[model samples]
Target: MKAEFATAERAVTLGVRETTDGLKMSMRRQVTSAGLGQRMANTWRGDNYPKGQNSIRAAGVVYTKASRIMEGFEDAAVIRSKDGWWLAIPTPNAPKRGVGGKRINPSNFPEHTYGRLRFVYRSGKPSLLVVDNARASYNRKSGQLRGFRKASDRAVSKGSGLTTVVMFWLVPQVQLPRLITFNTEAKRWFDRLPQLILKNWPD
Candidate 1:
């Protein structure tokens, strides 16, 4: 009688599935670890960014979708939607919420969030908030901003009048240090698929 062995096709399939599940779980865990988020957050909170620009560090880097936006002080750190997973830093181009809960375009944010923006100068100079080519004046007596309005011909004719409006953006610049850190590490995990399957194979 010829010696034969039963086919192990079902066992092989099961092994593959189990290894896949394990690897997926491991990847998820690695990506969502608090340590990873904290590391990314440190990068943002630190002064290492270009020209010492203050970055967002409210939550550092989180794993959830950007749709679950977080508001920190007057700044916001939002994530953008991607295929599997991704993260974003608060960029100067980040959108702002206008009246009636409308999403104001980044370029138009200066106009939309006009009243909320504040302008301060370290030196002895007039610091005025300008929005949408209009200067915002505050009513000191009422403790309320008068809002934006077009400068009249008389106002425009004055040379020193323009200097009174110190226009600047209020949005924070979003960065993605996590992308740089996680991409290579995640690839390494994916490359170990074969070894993972074999190591997890049934005895």
Candidate 2:
């Protein structure tokens, strides 16, 4: 599968098409693998890699560790794709309509009829919102954001204070079954949400 994080203004796409594709994704991230960051590294076109590398070194880390990171977000997680690509596709402006996917911020966000993605983070950790819309545009983008600066209570833990959260609304391609609480004690995150939003959002 592929992961796209797009915004009306900007978008970043990441994919793991296959074993070979993972390299492609890493290449898009930084391109330091084959010394693309240096003189020995270069792409078919005439693009100059700022980091001075031909492969994204971090992606390898991401692939080996994406599931570990998702342990607190989904019942199961894995990196699977074929193209192995990554990019930030720019857009004209904010989406004409916001990502109203199901099992999302129902109180604040429009009803999500399609798909949604949720990830976890500690209080103050870096976070983002990734989007890849197939009905409108089937591409991956991960830059900017997909929701509010402050995450709604719909997806937070019971009594958990406001913290960092990354979202990815994969309309028609949501990975998670539903929003869930992170079990810090068990060191596991499970999917157990109501079919509809709770009438009273417990603070």
lDDT of 1 by residue, 111-161 (tens): 433333344433443333333234545798996865444455576566333
TM-score of each: 0.31, 0.15
What ranges in model 1 sit over 4 Å off? 1-8, 34-96, 100-175, 179-183, 199-202
Q: Which ten contiguous residues of candidate 2 have the minimum total lDDT?
A: 8-17
Query: Candidate 2, 55: how far from true, in Å?
Result: 74
Q: Taking the tens digit of each residue's C-alpha lDDT, what string does model 2 give over 118-146?
A: 33233543332332231232225655334
Lowest summed lDDT window (length 10), candidate 1 = 52-61
lDDT per model, in order?
A: 0.38, 0.28
